[model samples]
Target: MLRAIIVDDEELSVKRLKRLLSESKDIETCHTFMNPLEAYEYAKSSPVDVAFLDISMPELDGMALSGLLLDLDNAMDIVFVTGHDEYALQAFDASALDYLLKPVTAERLDKTLAKIRKNRGYTAAEPALSVFLFNGLRLCRSRKGQETIRLRSPKTEELFAFLMFRRAISREEIVDTLWSDLETDKALKNLNSTLYYIRKAIGSGQTGDCIEAGRHEIRIAESSLYCDLYEFERLLKQIRSAPEPSADLFKRAEVLYTGEFLKGKSYEWASEQTRRLEQDYIELLEAAARFHIGIHQPQQSLRYFCEILKLDAIREDISHEVIRLYTELGRKHEAFQQYRLLEQSLQQELGTRPDPRVEDFIMKLMR
Candidate 1:
C-alpha cells in the first residue's frame, strides 16, 4: 500500500479526507495533522509516498510546506487540497502532482490515486473524462485528480451536450436540432465535420468507441463517460426510488448541482432541459430547507432559503422564512433589511408589494 500523510488546519476536513482515503485499498494513512509546523517536523523524520496538504492553513500554507517537504524528499508526490479554484494554477506551479476541490468525491479521489501509481511505474486504470455541463461545457480528462487535458469548441461542445442528454439520435434529428436554419445538404456536411472534430477533440483511440455512428443514428456510449448532468439525474432517481429519503441522499443531490445547467448556452433544444434542471435544483434546495427546519437547525435552513432566494428573489414564502430565521437568531437589523429589499424588489420589478402574510410577519417582528 502507498503510505500517505494529510495535513489540514480544519479538524473536520482532515477527518473527512482520512475517511475518503480509507476507502482506497491502494493507499494507507501514515499520519494526519491539523498543525502545519508539526506536520513539517514529522515529514522530516518519516518518509511517505504522498502528502495531501491544505492550501489555506495558518502560518505555513500548502505551497510553502510543499517546498519544505520536497527538500526532505525530492521524489515524494504532493497533492494540494483546497476549497478555492483560484489556487489551482499555483498548486501546479509548486510542482504538486494534483489538487482536489473541497467535498472531494470518491470517484475523483480514485483518479488522483491512479496518477500517483502511474508515476511510480505501476499500471493505472484509464481515468474517466469529467464533463461539466452546468457552467458552459468543460471537458476534463484527469489522472490522479489533476486535469491532463481540457477540450473546447463551441459547436462541438454543443453537439456533445445535445448528444449526452439524448444518448442516441438520428443524424437527421441532430441536423434539425443544431442546424435547422442551414440548408439540408450543408447541415449534413457540418454534422459530419463536427463529429470528426468531436471524436478528435476527445481522443478517439484513448476514449475508445465512446461516440459511435452507424448507418442512421449516432449515439454516445454511456459507459465511457461521467457527466454531471447524468449523475444529477441518477441521484434524483435514487432519491425518488428510496422508500425513505435520508439526509445523506439530499446532501448528495445538493452537491451535484454545482450551478445552473448549461448556463450561458442558448440552444433552442437545451432551453427545456435547462429549465427542468433549474426547477429540480430549486425543489432540492426547498426540500433541504425543510429538512433542516425539521431538525431545528435554523442556520442551515436559512442557508438553503437564501440560496433559493438567489434564484427567485420574489419567492415570498422563502423571504418570510429568511426573515423568521434572522429574527430567531437575534439578527433584527438583517431581518429588517431583508424585508425592505424584498419590498423594493417587488415594487420595481412587478409593481407589487409583499404578500399580506409577509407584511403581517414583518409588522409583528418590527414591533
Candidate 2:
C-alpha cells in the first residue's frame, strides 16, 4: 500500500480524483490539496509515495510544484492529473510517473497506479503504447478502451507520425522532410526540441524504450509499438488476396479505416498515401455494395453506394447506381434528388455537367 496526495486548484477535481483513488487497493491513504503551495508544504515534512499534481494550478503550477516535491524525495512518484494535454513534455521533464487527462476514469487511474507499482519493482511494465493514424493522429494506450495521447504541437505530432511511418529515418531526412523551409540551424534546433517532446510524450518507463534515437539515425522499436496503420493495411492485403473473401473479413478491414489516412491534417508527405488509402476504401465499399446487390438487399447496397459517393462526389458510376437503387426501393423522389446532387457536384468540381445518359437512366428508372 502506498500513501498518495493529490493537488489540484479545482476542489471538484480534487474530490473526484480522491474518490477514484479510494477504490484502489494499492493506495493505503489518499490526501487531497486544492493549493499547490500547501501540497508542496505537506510534501516537505511528510514524504508520500505518490504525488498527484494538476499541471495548471494557481500560485505555482504542478510542474514547478512537482520539482520541489521531488527535491524532497526523488523516490516519490509524481502523477500529473489535469484537463490540458499539452503539459506532457513538462510533466515528463519533471520526472513524473504518469500523465492522466481530465475527467479521469477509474480504469485510467488504475493504469497509472499500475505504472507506479511497476516503478517500485512490484511488477513488470506492460507494452501499452499504440499509434492510431486513421481519422487523425491518435497515440493510444490500453487495449480495453483507448487512452488517447494528445501531443503539444503539430510538429511534435508530425515528427512522431513520420517516425512511426518510416520506423527509422536519418537526421538529415527528418530535417529535410519536416523543416525544409527553415535555415539549417533553426531546423536542427526545432528537430532537437521536437525529438525531446516525442521521447517525453512516450514517457520514461518501459514504453520509452520503444523509441530509439541515435546521433545519425532514429528508429522506432517495432516490437514495443503497435501501429494501427500496419495492422489495417495487413488486413486489407489479406482480404484482397483471398480467393473468396468473407463479409466478416471485409467488415474487419472496413471498420479499421475510420477515415482517410490522417484525415483533416494538411501534411504534404501524407497526401499521396491518403489518396491511396482512400482508393482502397472506395474499392472495399464497391465490393461490399456488389455483395449486397447479389443478395437482393438493394437498401443495404444503396448505403454502400452513398458512402462511396460521399468520398468521391464525382463518381458518376456510383451516383447512377445510387439513383437506380433509390428508384428500385420505391423512392423515385430520392432518385431525382440523387441525380440533382450528382449534377451539382460534377458541375462545381469538374466544371462540367453530369453525362446526359445519367439523367436519361434516372428518368427511365423513375418511370
Candidate 3:
C-alpha cells in the first residue's frame, strides 16, 4: 500500500484525490494540506517517496517543494497535482521528475511509479491482500454463493467474503492466508473443516449444489445459487446495459436488497458490499415505488416504500407515501399506528424525529 499526501490549498481537488485513492486499498494514508507552508514542513521531516504537490500557491510553489524534496537526500519523489497543464510544464521546468494532471488518476499514478523505478531505481511494494484472515482460519468468501469455503485462515470470514464475491480461488492463495505461527499440518485440517462448514451453510436450504472443489481450485456452484450479492450485481449490469433506468430494474434492485448482505457480521470484507448495496437500494427503491404507484399497486408499493424507511427513515417521501396509501384506502387507524411506530423507531435508533411530511400525513389521515 502507498502512503500518500495531497498538498493542495484547494479543498475540492484534495477531496477528489483522496476519494480516488480510497478505491485502491493499496493506499495506507492520504493526508490533505491546504497550505503550502504546512506541506513544506511535512516534506522536510519525512521520506515522502511520493508527494502530490500543487503549483501557484501563497508561499512556496510546487517547483520549490519538489526541489526541496530532492535536496533532502531522502530519495523523495514528486508528482505535480496541478489543475492546468501549463503549471505542470512550469514545474517540470524546475526539474520535478514527473507531472500529473489535476484529478489524479490511479492509472497515471501507476505509470508514474513505473517510470520512477526505471530511472531513479525506486522499487514499489507488492499490492495488498484481496482477503484478510483472523480468528482461527474460519474462511468465508463473498464472491461465491452461499457456497462452500475453500480456504481457511485467521481471516477466513474476510476470505470467504472475497471468494463469495469472486467465483473461484486457488490452494496457494488459501495457504498464504494461513498464519505463520500455526503448524502446517494442523492448519490444513482446520482449513478443511472450515470449508466443510461453509458448504453446509450454503447448502442448508436455498440450494444443495453451491460449491465445487477441485485439485487446486475451489469455487461457488454458480449453476444454481441464490446469492443476494449475485442478484445485486446482475441488476447493476442490467441497469448499466439498459437504455435508461427502467421500472423493472429498480424493482429488482428493491427486492434484491432486502437486508444488508451479511448484516450483524463482524467481517471487514462485507462492510464495503453492505455500504454499496445500501446506497444503490435507496436510489432504486424510490424509482421502484413510483413505478408501482403509477401501476395502482399501492399495497405492493407500500411494502417497498416502507422497506426503504427501515434503511433510512429520514426519507419523508417514503413515509408520506406509505401513510397516504393507507389513508386513501380508508385504513386511517393503520396510518396513525404506523406513524407512531416510525416515530418511536427514529427516536430509539437514530435519536431524531420523522420529517414534517410524516406529521402532515397524520393530519390528513385524522380527517
Candidate 4:
C-alpha cells in the first residue's frame, strides 16, 4: 500500500491519471494537484512513495519540482508523466526512476510501480504528527486522518499556542506575556491551571510529549512536532538568503498562508505576527508576478496580480498593475471591470474613487 501524488497543470490530465492510479492495488491513496506548487507543498509534510509529475508545468516545471521533492525525501521515487519524449534523457539525469508518456497506459504505469517497488521495498505506512497553524491551530496525528483537539478553555488554547509560538520560554516570560493583567500570584496560578488543561487536552499519545515543562521554563519539543508555521518561516528564510530564490519555493510558502496566522483570535502578541505573515505573503505574490512578467507570461502574472488585490485590495498601485495586465492581455472589458471594482472599493471604504492616474491608465488602454 503506497501513497502517490499526481501533479499536472491540465485538469483532465490530472483526473485521468488519478482515476488510473486509483485502479492499482499497489496504491493505497492517490492525491492529485493541478498546481505544481501545491503538489510540492503537500509532499513536504506528507510521506509519498512516488510522485507522478508532468514534465512541463507553468510556475514550476516537473523536473525542478521533483528536485525539491527529492530534497525532502531522497528515498522517494520520481516518475515523470508527460506527452513528450525529448525530456526522457534529462528526466533520467535528474534521477527520475521512470518516464511515462502522456495518455499513460495501465501496463506502462504498472511497470513503473514494479520498478519503484524493486528499488525501494514496500513497507507499512508510518503514523505522523502534524500541526497546522495557517488558518488556525489544527493538529493532525496520523496519515489516516487529522485530529482536532478541543482545549478546556480559550485561555488554555492560548497558552498552548503561546508555547508553540515561542518554542521555549521562561515561566516568568510566559506569565508576563499571557497573564500580565492578573495579580502576580493569580497569574502564576492561572498559568499552572492552563498548563494542566492543555496537557489534558492533548492527552497521552504521539503528541503527548510535544510540550515539555521545566521548573523555570516550558518548551515545545520540535522533534515531536511537524508544524506548518515552522516550515513556512523556514522557507521564507531560505528564499531570502538564496542567491537565486526559486519561484516554486515562493509559491510553496505562499500556499501555506491560507489565512492570517492564528486567525479569528485576539491574542495581542499574535496580531503583529499576523500582519507580518500577510505582508510576507503579498511580497511572495509580488515576486511571482515579477517572475512571470520577466518570462513574458502575462496570463500567469495577471493571475498573481489578481491574488495580490484579494489580499490588499486598497493598493491603488497593485490595482493599476492589474489593470495594465488585463489591458495587455487583451482583456479590456475585464480591465474596465477591475477599475470599477477598485473605484467602488475606494469610494465605499475610503470615500474616494480610483486614483486619477488609474483612471487615465484605463482610459488610454481603452483607446
Error of 3 at 73 (Å): 69
TM-score of each candidate structure, all chains considered together:
0.63, 0.59, 0.43, 0.63
lDDT of 4 by residue, 1-367 (tens): 6899999988888887786676555688899998999998898889999899998998899999999999999988899999989998999999999999877765566678889877887543343566677788776666334666777888887888888888999999998999888988999999988898777767755466888888999988765657778878877765664445656777778778878789887899998888888898888888888888888988888888899999878899888889898878788899899898898889888998878889888778767
Global lDDT scores for all candidate models: 0.83, 0.82, 0.64, 0.82
Query: 43-111 in candidate 1: lDDT tens per residue?
Result: 888878899999998999999999999999999999999999999999999999999998666656778
Clashing pairs in 1: 111-144, 112-144, 112-145
* Number of the candidate with higher lDDT, 1 or 2: 1
Per-residue error for 233 in candidate 1, Å, reads: 1.0
Candidates in order: C-alpha RMSD to true structure? 14.4, 18.7, 13.8, 13.2
Clashes of each: 3, 0, 26, 0
lDDT agreement of model 4 with the native? 0.82
Residue 285, candidate 4: C-alpha displacement in angstroms: 1.2
Better of 1 and 3 by lDDT: 1
Candidate 3 stretches with Cα past 4 Å from truth are 1-158, 166-227, 240-258, 349-352
Error of 2 at 168 (Å): 2.7
lDDT of 3: 0.64
